[model samples]
Target: MSIPKYNEIMPNILRYLNTNGEQKFRDLEQPLAIEFGLSDAEIIQEYDSGNGTVFLDRISWALSYLTNSGLTERPRRGVYKNTELAQAFLDKPTEEIQIFVKQQMALRTAKQKAEKAEEGQLDESSDLLMENNQTPQEMLNTAHESIRQSTYDQIIDTVLSKTATEFEGLVVKLMERMGYGGQVKNAGTVTQASNDGGIDGIIREDVLGLGKIHIQAKRYAKSNTVGREEVQKFVGALAVAQSNKGVFITTSSYSAGATAYAESLNGTTNLVLINGEQLAKYMYDYSLGMQTKQHIEIKEMDSDFWDGMQNDSKVG
Candidate 1:
């Protein structure tokens, strides 16, 4: 069978529990997975909070739900056995799977209400742990992205207020890391004389060593957006370069008028814009002038060398 949905996994669980008689939660997972055509990877898709994919944590939740709904009973907190509902379902074979699942859900919903009435919220932090979870490195990267967005935004805002020389160095470092060293001509290399069309830096984009596209970087405040006039000037510069492509980047949001102006394609140049958020994300992903922090270690089992199996006679 194809990979089943969240609800569909339950009937298979009931079938397994009914046939197996009883099993520890940990023990049930593998067989349950195998019977349902799920590999270790896909078993976790059957929970309420499955991060858009399945995890062993979801399998745990499935077990908890089964226990709560009266289809399974926990002999101990961790041990599970088939309940009357599970037994009955096995006795009466149903071709209509949907009805059986609905019945199972109804029982669990009622059980949850009864439990809440009897005891206030018991700590469920343990319940949050997902099964076959992500490695620490993957999780660390996820957390880092969140941290860097806020941290970098603040840093970018602060850097924008600094002297032009400081800004120049920061831009150069970031740009160099982003693979634009040779392509970038001035790149804060030469200080613009006075106000030169508000164009801060110049970059040459060569596609596979063929054709060149010019780029202009603008760093501004959050409130500031590249207006039509600014875009017009950039377009004018592209015309001077006799180029059909240009990039206008800012450390702030873009105005709709400015965006429309670039999109007008006025039979001239194609101007691409990248705002603050996009810029920071690219920088973060590319690790552009950014330092890596504490690495998280993800644990795994070594099955190639099992912990030396005992002889059959030795156990007896």
Candidate 2:
């Protein structure tokens, strides 16, 4: 049989956790597969992306959706247990699984709408789950993007709340987290110089401190915009520091002319301009000043298994 859709896996996941109390994610895959009478080939099936075994991915999403709906709680990473809602659902007759699933999905949708409303972004995209066109994978992707956008907004608000010096320190920390300086000892340094060059900080490219990347941070509000003159001064500071690369990060955006001027000198100097949105994205990506709230592991098909299966069939 084919691997079940993510929704179909939800009941099994809840039932397993409800019985087992608490379990690691990997421990549930084989038992659930056996319970479903899945064949060896089906058990090994993967998605097109080669991320992981398909059955496991479905189980992961089942757990994720359940958690989102407050039916389950992940006490720590890679662990899951039933909540009161899940236990109550399980306590009902087995025939009630379908009703429970629908109820949970409705709750999840309502919660999503409430979150979008709070973010002031309740729009058409937020209603995609209700639309008929999206596949299960598309639904999962949309949910993932929504979480990321929410994080991005939170990061922007957090940076906006910091002092100018504190913001500079955040940029330095982000650079260090991105592996700019090989060692944490002096991978990056913030220069609080009032009248020195326009540069705000410097990060080493390696542990030995061989090469350097210059940094300039602007803590401007979203309404303010960085202009051409700022970029020009940053370039001048690069010249003074004898550095070829510089990163100009701002909580605001850059004007078109500023971007054009920076692009005009792309070949002469490698300058990377990071605006508020991009800066927040990088911070989230590099895990700077952030913690792992939850994890959603996406699994895909394994082509090698099928290829080997075909080879074995031909040999037989």
Model 1: lDDT to the true structure: 0.60
C-alpha RMSD by candidate, in order: 9.4, 14.6
Q: Highest lDDT among the candidates is held by which one?
A: 2
Task: Put down candidate 1 lDDT per residue, 126-174, tens digits, no spaces.
Answer: 3322213332233444566678778678656776787765554555456
Error of 1 at 144 (Å): 4.5
**lDDT per residue, candidate 2, 257-306, as tens digits?**
99999999957889999999999899988888889988777665464664
Residue 168 displacement in candidate 2 (angstroms): 0.7
Which ten-residue region of model 2 has the weakest summed lDDT? 307-316
Which regions of candidate 1 deviate over 4 angstroms?
Answer: 1-145, 181-198, 204-213, 264-268, 302-316
In order of appearance, the predictions have TM-scores of 0.53, 0.56
Total clashes, candidate 2? Answer: 4
